[model samples]
Target: MDGTSSPGLARSLFLLLVVLLSSSVAFIEPCDLLYDQAVQAFYKGDYGGVVRSMEGALHSYAQVRRSKVGCRLRCEDQHPFDDDDAAAAAVAELRFFDVVLRRSACMNGCIEDKLGTQSMHRVSEDVVQDFHRRIPYNYLQLAYQKLKQPDKAAAAAHTYFQANPEHVEMGQNLEQYKDLQGVQEDHFVDREARPHQHSFSAGVRLYDQGDYEGAIVLFEEALEEYYKADVECRALCQGPQRFEGHNHLLYRYSLHELISVFRCTSLGFLENLVKRERCLSRKRWGCPSQTASEASGMDMFGRPFHLHGRLCREAGGFVVKAAWYLRRHKQELELLLIGSATMGVEFSEGQYWSSTGGREDSNRIPSGTDGWMEYVPISEKKNVSVMSPPQLREGGPLVYDSVRLVQNSIALNGTQRVLLDAVISEEECSDLKHLAHTVTMAGDGYRGKMSPHTPNERFEGATVLKTLQYGYEGRVPLRSARLFYDVSERARRIIESYFLLNSTLHFSYTHLVCRTAITGQQDHRNDLSHPIHADNCLLDPEANECWKEPPAYTYRDYSALLYLNGDFEGGEFIFTEMDAKTVTASVKPKCGRMVGFSSGGENPHGVKAVTGGQRCAVALWFTLNPLFRELERLQADEVIQALDSQAQSQWDHGLHINPKDEL
Candidate 1:
């Protein structure tokens, strides 16, 4: 009887041990475990203990980052499953993504599934993990500050800053730490700031100081670190990277954006040198090429109520391929396109416009039309026609015997659109770059101190407006400001002549743009200097449609990016399909090299991130319509015209001015 009872008791004891282990497995958040101890030490006012626990917490985060569990959690955290069932579906498909995404999500889910019912709902594990890696230095920064150790405090602040360059407060804190009695730049070192970031930052600093060899040595080290980091980053699933999600069905993205205030797109309405460009509305808006009559009463998805007056104001800005200009008639406005007949455009509800019935005057709208209507005047109207592509050898208006316009296999088959070489000289490129750096550093860029890119980037773009503003102030050379026009004008001539538009092109916009990488920002980087986009329309990747609406510079007929300095890593100009991936063409930037293309969804393009050194370029946007002329360019032309009478030139005119001439 005793031997039988002993066997049963042993089995019960084994079962009891299994229950305890299972419960222990439910608490798998090691970062949380270490963090709880730090929190307890903080509450107890044991500052040393808090530091020690946080050190362990940071190690836990690093270990988790090296593990598949953290990588999978981060990949999914970016675009969280919008529903519980979707989350379940995602969890079930981990194996598929493990192969597709190249990260083993299956093991991560397996490790995380043990915490299913016992999971903490207060904060996401991935978010906490990120904080665990970066924010401990921030806490340590404050702790060391409280401990009266300025050197260690500065080091902590610097570490946090390296991890997050865009954090306004930490940048300020780092500035303060640097001011501390004996804290030098050397004190701003971190052991955990991604080995690549340290090497890259040092390289960039050296490069900026003209120490190219030293910078190169460091850059090579950075590259080696980059490969290691790439593997580690994959394991962490960190950054604002786009990844495959189970919510592919929720990819209903419609960018009803215009430049500012309001957005209006023309649908199949392009007049001969007198009509605004038409864009097919994107998703749920029906046919892209529907006539105004067919598109009547359609919803302008993002048009605000304040845009009632600004709709046509913004619509009038768009210039199609034909180089048409719009004008206003007395009370009645007419928008005539080459493909359409004399039809009456009636605006009923102030939402959509439709054309129907007959009107004798093809160029004028019918009497008493409502809402916003654009018309062309009789004097400005011309017999301009978009005949065909220009045969350059046949002697077009512009000749380039010395220059080479290489037709790249970019979008639109690349015959008309080209990569222009030798249009602008090397000296001209240098001056414009100098002007860009000078004017942009004067706090006159589009975003003023902040770049118009993802976090951890520094963007400096000086528009024709700012360049002229600085030139007038004598901060920039007059010749540099004029060169911006001269170079862009050369590009315009190429577009007008090559595209064979009988009418000349006009400057819609001109910008001298620069992008630089800030160290430690890679953790949040999307890896694009400029996200893939169309100059005149918003690209809808999921629907494969180009939404031409507000915020997009739809008035732009052609885009020309003239490359300046090229001693940088990355920053390649890539032409993509409407999908924004699937590279069709890539143009490496160099002095005097210009990429000319149609500014539509058909020519979606973007600049890759400038990983090292400074990248400078002149972004030139052209429009056919004189009405939508770049006002800033006109202002610059005025300033140049005052100084040099020969500068009284249109961006589309034949050359009478020297681009390399400096004031």
Candidate 2:
């Protein structure tokens, strides 16, 4: 009986021990749980998740302190220790906080690597401020360096060295930072001097408005400033001081602008000349005919002779009468004379010369007589202008105009081939605009115009509204991905149908751009007007001579634009022919409108300025490579899984959470 009872008692005790251990594990401190989650997230390459977990950990630590002090030990909280156990707990909490801070420092770096350096600014303000306060300044220094903010990086480095004067690497880092600061200051001075930012801005404004002459004047002034700055830079480089790299960007920029202006001016002149010639030819027969004469006397072949000629046009042919003289006993005597000369004209009815015999050879002229010549005007072929297609009638759910062939040939073959229409519904347009607004609110507004000093001067005032770019393996915000998929799918279908391409061709990464109007009294330099350019060329304006080889596996063969909102002024999509003077098409943005074309030299295009209100559009680029299909498929699946998980979480928590709130 004792043996049986002991076996049952042993089983009961084992079960009780297991239950107690489970409870203890479940009741672990919230901070510890959060920190563990953060570590797991970091290992999974989920930097955003890591940041969220760390934030929760910090909050949990705060709650623990509050509960320990009964919410009334503000002064004692500084020491936060009533006994050895309490002191140890307090020390452990501080160590945890330090670990959290260190992990958060890597957040921006990971984000930059996955997205781009420009995306670092999208990090939360709270996270950034906390990092600045708690982490070493080196992280901030590295971030600012990546951002190209040298001054800020230098300041951070300076603060770091001051804090750790005896640090092993402090001397080396401090020296490097000082040198960087000096270089930055030099560049700042040079930037201020050359192109005189204000003057350059004014020049760009004039150029955009078609005021070529005014633009030329301002550009020249900017050019002068560049020259002076360059001279000073050279002198500085020759001294005994440490040699910082010279910046010739402004000089190069000014030269490029001058060249572009000159080219545009010459093209404008040629276009005007062609138009004037066309007009003159229309009234050629009605114009009055005029006669002119000239005389000269000179020694030729050791003989003195006098010559006289009269020139006139008759029946679309030039006629000349001439007389020549020879000296006889110091007296000038006429030796050769010609009259009623009609040049290169067939003898037809009343148009024949009366005095001149038909087919007279040159030998028939008297010795020393002046020689008469005639010129027959060659008939020029008349150019018949190709009529433009009739404009589409307004007020319709959908309207479109197929580009008409010009001069009975394929119209703007290549990149210029475009179909314009309101393709999507107003609902989609409204939804996209709302999504863009939400994205803007979640981050520091849009990244303003970048590297305005690029060769493409038109980019100076161009502000990107909300841009989202991702590789096939990278994750994109759910809303942005949805918008991208919908617009690109529709655009791909349309392009395939129009071009009769195989449906197997798929699209690659896309770029979404939004532009707003220039406000206040600033010159329209910042207005978004993409200069005429091929989509597949070297992006740097300074590297105009660089030619990118066509991709082997994939090519940006086709480009499409979907306009989300059209209630804007001045922004028109303009396509120019190879000559740059002829506009193949000028499309106005309309809500739900889509315009697509080839993306090579065959279709150079640009945007006009956005004068009022705002403009938003999604640009989708397509490729023909088959390898990208698998990548795109995997990405789509990942997006689906992410969406499902998010939905499940929201439902489980019984909370109406915005997907972007996670971002």
Candidate 3:
């Protein structure tokens, strides 16, 4: 009876807290409300209150994960994946981006639904960090200990210890639990852990028992949950930083307006290059760096960055906290790689209402974007009016005021150099789209071969060579082929100028590709049309690293996509972290909008599933090495020139050449 009443008490306390802090953080997660209840209960000697509140808090996580409440990303307004040989072979694959966005949107929507306000999606650092790090276990173990439930207390302690094995205090507590009565070895593990552990362990057992179907189901759960857990960690990493004295500093200032303004005390600078190397966030990506004295200004890529020298607060102090959750994901990967059932299960959020997330106050730029969220929106990036080449090319498109491609995000010396522009005219876009339909062949990207991804849909592509060949054979319009070649060359010149290369960028590969959703394959579709990947490296999913050699187009240094039309839906291009789990930035497809970026692991990207009409684009790649330039491009141009000459000569001769007589 007491156990049930505690949840009611928590809901009451949660309502009261909301009324009190409503004016503060407009958005608060659902689990956070229960978590707040647990914190209140702990302070008032209500140990049972803590257990009830935390349990409720943990279960409430299902709200963000479940699809019933519009938590999953909606592709309902569009068509579904095509039911092809590839789509029929397997179930739809959910990727890192789909899970991350779905979960983030769910959390946001859940908060908004509960509070009836729009403030929740921007979760405070305390809430994001606390929940994922299993901080509730910290309170739960102590609450259980005081409640005299040694078995439960030992389990909670073990869970927290696994997340933070370096903490001496937790280590000592575990040592004491060994001698505690009623605390068995089986009791020293998280029983209500994330769903994957049980499913995976059960699958291993079933596999050994030769229950193949049951084993398959369990393995699927493990795989899906592994995808979900990785998102939970990456989301937490995006929130604000609260170091040792953040709250105290808040108290030191009394003015309400000044309340939002506070700086981090210079807590020593970190010179650890080795540590940063292990981190997904690094400054050495192709972005140009500036020293402290340098003023904030725009670069050629059009990214605005301000250098703070030694004056800024270091994230290392607070950032390392995220590594704990990242390690959990790594362990899950290890669990899958080894396919072992013996792995341990574990996992577990609040705040003084820090003002770091607010715009016009103390804040940090979001990773993978240029000035977004206090953000620099893609719509506002029209600064570079010209090619701005480092050196003049004698025959380059001299003035491109109306045809420039703008960099979507700042480089910050990072791998991202994504540029967005609408250089093609509406007529040209229509022409290219028409040409794609004219020359498209069976199969999609693989060209009549089996899709490496799903069997549901098709990927169709025509290279410049194929387009030219088809046009000469009188199968497609000759003008459309010229249009395709012209657009690709324009993309190549834009890429060459934007990166400010000392030498010219040669065309390595240019393709016109289209992806379509099969009518009726739309149900249960949440996967990307093109899975997240780096252009120049082979992604080893188990290792979480992109190997930069061999079969990959190692010579290709840059990539660009020239969208012919935006008549479709749900096909946005996004730049992501190496894991392809967290989206750093996203660009919607539009007529004539070409997004270009480096073709390496420094800039991982993918296409969202096109749920509406067919999505078509001209994909282009450039290489610094001239030897590897598209030799076939030269042949295609030569053939087109020959056709032009033959037509002109026939017209000049005033005679048809069907008799096989030339001259």
Candidate 4:
């Protein structure tokens, strides 16, 4: 089909026609041979030979008839020109034929034949744009680096900030250079050192050689040795837990880098050993020890603290809920909160609780727990619906009785002073007092150990019913009520108010205020897909026995857990949902950072086991009242009626109508 075919076909046809017409002498096949030779010569760049052969064939053809070929081949039937003339004329004609046209056709044919071996050289712009939108932040950054366009790289970084504004440094840097052109050279420092920098190089080598389990053991031994050395160094410097006389930043940076390697590896035991190193360093650096007296006090970083009172949910009169934060405010809390989730804290009594505990009797609202009992319908949408659980009698860990106990215990020296022995700034004292009374009634479980009256009365630890984890029972009188006053009263009000205004539902609350050393893992039940739900929902399905008064039915509205103190570290919340969507929101152990969210099939939350420190908190759950129940029943009835009526109408029409006539 292409122009590369031989000219011999034309010559042969011409010669044959000549033989048939005049019975020409010799009936020479020389024309065919000459044409074949011309093609061979052409391959060898013999343009002259090709022209001669083509001209001879044309002249021979012109002497004969034009019957064999198509109409274009009907040339003059006479050999009017000599071979030389014919050759010149043929060559001129070929040259006049559009070379570009022939080349275009040939190019297409070549492309088709090579398609199987070729890669598509280009992608449409739309595809690239789509990738930019959905790709992960780290991947997008690498992509921009490859593109070598500083502006685009900066823009991608900005997009990352928009999505995760909690990354303070990254966000601030991005905002400073919104119109990115050239970046400052020192903006980023590659602080990631070679892994061997750590004194535990031998352990790292063992890990690299596929001895992960063994490496962990050796790493712990090295960590112990390092701690002993650091302690001696502290003694030489002055005392334990002080950073001095050296490049403090570099020292801190190196420590952080070393810790990061263990954290990244997810080798929990090795990480624990590294934390021991941190503890020694802290003592040497003069970091104040978080004593029982200090943690129980009301002052936070020497400031009079006031949480957003409006953004909480109230239960048993005590406000109980998590604090919701916009992106900007995450930083103020991050250092306090995120640091706690990182550093493992221990109980003053030498015991430490794991991060997460098993699901417990969620159906029953613990005594002193107070949360939303009424669901305020905000908006109505054709495709969306919201409802809360029915209201029931307030029982378990009674709030009113607990509040009275707290009020009687705290003796105020002056009207200005709220509670006796309560170390707080003037501003904080004022805020605490206001929050207490504003919360008409506040109640929560006493911070103590839990025990059954009889051996049989307690569900065997194996029983699923026994799985709910509560704080330890039996506490010192002086500290217990004081701790409760802040958490159950002051903190509770803020959480309750916040939820009523912003959150949709929060029905279950479980607060653990650590007064004694807590050590050992609490049972865990991830029976539901996103197994770790917040303390809002109770595990017991027998609703009647769990609540002070039965709900008349079963339902939970919402729940929250609030960290009241951030003296120690290493307690992060873990949540997993269907579709393998796992989210771990780290709660900084700060005075007032609250974690508030929905709990149900849609959102299940849990706290990651604490590694190094004692964790304390105030938890609250919300239940729907009469209004919540009435609305839900009404909606369900409507849907059922509508479906039934539609079915009946269809049947009636089918019996009476004729299909053809109806159409």
Most lDDT-accurate candidate: 3
**For model 2, where is the 10-residue window of minimal lDDT?**
317-326
Candidate 3 lDDT tens digits, 54-157: 87777665444332222121221122344353553433344434444555665565445544454433344446557766788889989999999988888887
Per-candidate Cα lDDT values, in order, are 0.54, 0.41, 0.57, 0.32
lDDT score of model 3? 0.57
**What is every candidate's alpha-carbon RMSD to the true fold?**
30.4, 37.9, 27.9, 39.6
lDDT of 1 by residue, 585-644 (tens): 888888878777778776888888877778888888888877688655655554555456
Listed in order, each prediction's TM-score against the native is: 0.40, 0.33, 0.38, 0.21
Ten residues in sequence with the least summed lDDT for candidate 4: 313-322
Candidate 3 lDDT at 297 equals: 42
Q: Cα RMSD (Å) between model 3 and the true structure? A: 27.9
Candidate achieving higher TM-score, 1 or 3: 1
The segments of candidate 4 whose C-alpha lies over 4 angstroms from its true place after superposition are 1-486, 500-512, 515-531, 534-554, 567-569, 579-581, 626-663
- Estimate the lDDT of model 1: 0.54
lDDT of 2 by residue, 441-516 (tens): 2112222323232222222111121222222223334455465555656667766566555445476545455665
Model 4 TM-score (2 dp) = 0.21
Give candidate 4's error at residue 64 in angstroms: 99
